[model samples]
Target: MGTRGLVAAMALMLCFGVDRVVSDASDHRYKAGDPVPLYANKVGPFHNPSETYRYYDLPFCSPEHVKEKSEALGEVLNGDRLVDAPYKLDFRVDIDSKLVCKKKLTKEDVSQFRTAVTKDYYFQMYYDDLPIWGFIGKVDREGKTDPSEFKYFLFKHINFDVLYNNDRVIEINAYTDPNALVDITEDQDIEVEFFYSVKWKETTTPFEKRMEKYSQTSSLPHHLEIHWFSIINSCVTVLLLTGFLATILMRVLKNDFVKYTHDEESAEDQEETGWKYIHGDVFRFPTNKSLFAACIGSGTQLFALTVFIFILALVGVFYPYNRGALFTALVVIYALTSGIAGYVATNFYCQLEGTNWVRNLLLTGCLFCGPLFLNFCFLNTVAIVYSSTAALPFGTILVILLIWTLVTSPLLVLGGIAGKNSNVEFQAPCRTTKYPREIPPLPWYRGTIPQMAMAGFLPFSAIYIELYYIFASVWGHKIYTIYSILFIVFIILLIVTAFITIALTYFQLAAEDHQWWWRALLCGGSTGLFIYGYCWYYYYARSDMSGFMQTSFFFGYMACICYGFFLMLGTVGFRAALFFVRHIYRSIKCE
Candidate 1:
């Protein structure tokens, strides 16, 4: 009852927590003539999401009193810092050309603008709860063949086209006029007037579908493209692998089972061969059982988290690449599922005859989060040094720490206590012998390393195509909104991993290798190494990313992600091998 109640509570929180969040500044719909707040978000090279600075970091006009919109947890975590803009836009109001400000540019100001233009920097703004994006300046080539003839011009005139349904905003678009371009190719002092115009139009689109326009914008990274060929190819590969497993592995195991059952009376006279010989040692607990159990528990929790978020995404709770929305859900869901980790780790550790429950509990909590903290801290330091908006503020760090200390700690304790009280015993089909058996040496091909390398390739090959799209969405300006395809690929990855691990474990046991516990787990996780290798390839061959800021952010977070994949896939493989060993050993006649 207690566990059920807690799960129910967490589910409710996950469902309702989104509604309670307020990313937009407006609390209520405004009437006509009421000034709507326009907020400036961040400025960065359009190609790179991580290399962002505050909008005001550039030499833009600032208001007399700097005011900012109150942000939610999602907003803060997404690196969003929304401040009041200089533009005055009212709901459903048309305004002529109005001068925002006229300022004399210093040499330093011109240099800054020139640098921004060179990098193709763009700015983001929010008007009436709708996000708007525009490039700060444009680069022009006077002579296509000559690098010296290239020129940079800043966009001084701001034009906003806002579409609204009767009382609500449907969309907002920002545009630049060619006549208003200010030449800034050379360092020269010039007076510039920033002018803005707002035109409101009525749209037939309902308020509910306002976010649809974002998907239509070519300027935004909301393009939802599904590589049908790649997806189909992956599907075919996985199907073949599954067919092989079903026909060959299953048939081989079946023949062994029948032969052993029928020839039990002659077994004592014949010398022991194959996996049956090591039945007594197959279930021996691996070294450092507590840590291994914690990793499995963390992996289980991550698997659950993956499913939950993908379901939410599929059901349209939110779309992909909406950083604020997606990031918040991940954080909230991960913490809520911490209890599962504690329960699984504690239970598994207890079954291993581990006496120190407290140490096991702490290991369960720290297994994944500890390394993640170090990774985040290193990335944050880089962001700070570069003065990028990607850095987490002091307040946001406190919030995360508080969540771990107050929320995660208590729930983990509750789950651990429940797991301890359950008192489940480890059940082995064959009794472990008091004296250890000397195992026979194997050939190079049968070695643990060779098995892992071979076992991991099948799974990695099955999903390598989808892996490209995923990497593009994360490190590049691509939006991946194909949840159904993603779900299919995820299932394929897990299935291939399980079957491959099972096949490898069976081969090892047949070779009289009783030390299969860690080998099976690692065999499943080796896919991460391939994935990390792909990351490097994509960085060099696929993406246009450069510079220290973006480079550090990309590799740092990606390493952590690859580690997570290792643990998740490893857990799946380990569980499958364990099930296979128990079933085969339990069925065959053994002394």
Candidate 2:
């Protein structure tokens, strides 16, 4: 209870929870005298997930030769930096008190404790593969505090509460007693002792349900309400787009077709400036067809990936508490699904009479992976500089590379070969001209930028609210469990993107632009721009997240997400536009 002394122990609390993706590397079926180990992981300020450091870096009385336990791939990616601890614990056993170590605190040690307490750092550790977090210490400060009024206190002793069921370790909890606090106000070298106690309790709860309690009290809200407003907004978006497309197909396009087909108007008086009149150039395949095809292919693959993940998640393949289950699935599935991208891209390229099959295939393979690799390297460098847990080890990086090389590459090549040999061709109703007709000066709304903006707005509106929750889970240490609503929003986003893109394509063709291929893709993908804008806004609002490593991590992550959106939505829109253009031109007579 002294105001001037060296710190005995420091307790830290973490917002987000962690779980062993694989088991804790120990056989949980322990006999009566089995020794249970408590492994210490990284520590960081509770507010910043990317800002993390090794727990032993805090000058804790760790073992003389501290050794780190090997972690699974998923565990490392989730930022686990495990180090051996000196405390002794055993399964199905209890100890009243344990003296970890006694050491004389140097000036540097006292300063370290003061900084950690002021920053409100948290400690992470694993016992029986279950993660437990505690705040290192607490700071008592007066309102608008003067420097003289701030008092820093470190929790000297920690108590572990273990709940086991059916002889299997189930849940873990760590607590700091208020009476066991040491103040670190004095600047001189002081003596300190770090001690801990353990209590083992038998519980009836099943092993599978052990993580249930942590789920209820993480950074996210325990009680989830149905997001009715977002769902209703999505529904409205669907209706609005459906009505607009219906009107264009049933009314406007109908009138335009009827005029040139039936009315034998004079050449001077005929509407020479409409979609029906530009049939020859409408299907003329946009410039940079290979790049365009690559985008489409990549997007198709991403779409497939999304659906596959949703199905798997619905079947309960991914347990929420499994720290890296979702991530592992994403990497593996994305790699295995490379064939989808290769085949789709090859088909589109052949349809446009593309010559360089190899180049196209290469581009398709690099579509997402290229940018992702570059971004990862940049952020990883920053993480290494900060000695943060967010930095990936070389072994993990090699594993990812091997997955892509051994699995993803061969599948992609096989797919490309299949598509190339099939010899697909574009079946245009009207023959495209050797040269494109001159496009007349169009109104402002008919421009590509305007059309893309209009095309993206409806789809972006549908998912904007859902994105907030998703962002919170990724960056704000919140857990999102409403996959049903997420899938609904996803479906709605795709439909709206397609319909809106079709509408824009029709307008561009109506304005006599004739180049609908890339327009539709760009227009549909513009939703990514809107999402990226929201990313910027979120960064500004969360200004406490400063420093180079954390900033790069956030933006790099968001860039990949936005790029995927662009590909997925853009492909959806392009397909819809292609279908509309083919159907309309086939139905009408063009002389």
Candidate 3:
């Protein structure tokens, strides 16, 4: 076979292997005496309102007993729990009591097992974050149980349990004194010890196997091929754009340098047009310098935090299965990186010749985070009202606030002071005139809005496919385990952002528009606008999520996330534009 054919065959084999593994995992069969271990999930939310209860697993049987019984019975009867925590088990009625015993119980057997029993049959079982309820025995109208019959039935079921063909059984032990029946109440704190045992019959049904296969196959790694394709496509586009821009920039700068230096005597006679005429005003302090500096500061911090989290996720520190790890890492890293925010904001503010260090530092800390917190509070309030598990509890909210106050706030202060103390003047190739240059009216296509629209779309396209998967993971049932792919796409996104911003800035400067500082930032940051548009499309067209609580929660948090993206990307674009502008201006003769 040719190389292409061989590659295709390998790909097909890989796909088949993945499917087989999923099928095997789901269709795993256990023998009649196989041990089915129960893992403890979180405690009941309604029961533990204060959230102070520390629950532990119930080790009902000793290791020696489990090992001895395994050998004696010639089967595995015990297993270790996957998670360690005490679980709540509530009982309900097993109405269809078709006995699977070989022999019927006699009157003497019933009398021997007679004991005190509960009037109500109610119990709750919790495993894998789902709760199941089953009853102990039948109850009469007077709310009383027949002790002798119940005991006899229970004993017969336990002793003569048969694994029928194509059937399985789960045996749970309700810890109670043999001489007395335990009464369960909703409000009462009764500790119930539960154990699970799986008994698989000799014969298996096709439906059972198919159902198992379906369950296993449902959690296939999400869109691996699509993600790879997107990453490759984005990288190619970025490279092409980067090469085009680099080639044009180098050639233009080289020609301009040669012309300006060699023709200096006749320079006055020639036209002073294009970026060559704007070296003086290009580096002049932009309007609203304080706000600009604050944005850069916050953006720098966000960029650092994003990079750190992605690195951690790539190294397997935070997997999708590990609940809350990603959010915990984000919060911790953001708090720790507050110094970056303060330092960048203060240094830029000082470079702009602004002495209001206090205001600059304060705005740097609050500009993005404050609005985010307020939005979170609103969404959290809605969640609390709906009693949704997604909402952070009051205690957790307080803890986050404390972390910000104690850790993040102090670091920002220190970073700001250091930045102010080490501040230096802005660098410019030519001296600014006493008055600002008059910027001519730009055509419709050369306007800021048009430039931003053009610059933003390409970057957004590069990451939109990956963004879809990320949205599904966050809002839908999909698990995002492919962080390695996400990291690559992230790098691609940055490269695209920088290259596109540079190209746009060059165009604007070539058009003799020196007001490129804010334009550069906005041009790159407009990708966030496209992202928000995709979010709207996903919510309406691609998702089935409805109701006020979910809607509010989704948009509320998304707004904050998009805002941060705006800051981070805008900073990246502006910095790239700055470097490009400086190099071009520095390359030519500037008198």
Kindly list the per-residue Cα lDDT of model 3 for residues 175-202, writing each as its tens digit. 3223322232222333322233222233
Model 1 gets an lDDT of 0.78
| Order of models, best TM-score first | 1, 2, 3
TM-score of 3: 0.67
Backbone clash pairs in model 3 (N, Cα, C under 3 Å; residues 3+ apart or in different chains), count: 12
Q: Please say which candidate is ahead in lDDT: 2 or 3.
A: 2
Task: Show model 2 residue runs off by greater than 4 Å.
Answer: 1-20, 24-27, 217-223, 237-249, 257-261, 264-273
User: What's the distance in Å from true for residue 74, model 2?
Assistant: 2.4
Question: By descending lDDT, how would the candidates be arranged?
Answer: 1, 2, 3
Give the alpha carbon lDDT tens digit for every residue of 317-387 in model 1: 76532435665676677778889888988998999899898899999988888877786788788888988
Model 3: lDDT to the true structure? 0.58
Report the C-alpha lDDT of model 2 over 1-591, residue by residue, as the tens digit: 000000000000001112335444356766665776678887887666677888888988877688888876556666777777666777777877788888788988888998888777888887776777899888877574685678888887999888887668888889997888778866668777888998988989988787676546332442344466556766786677678777866798778777766654436356655787787788788899999999989988888877877886676665555655555566667777888888889988998899998999999999787887786788778878877777788998888788788888998999888888888787889988899999888788777888878888888888888887777667655666667778888888888888888877877887788877888899999999899889888878844666666667777777777888888889999999889888988887666
TM-score of 1: 0.93
Error of 2 at 440 (Å): 1.2
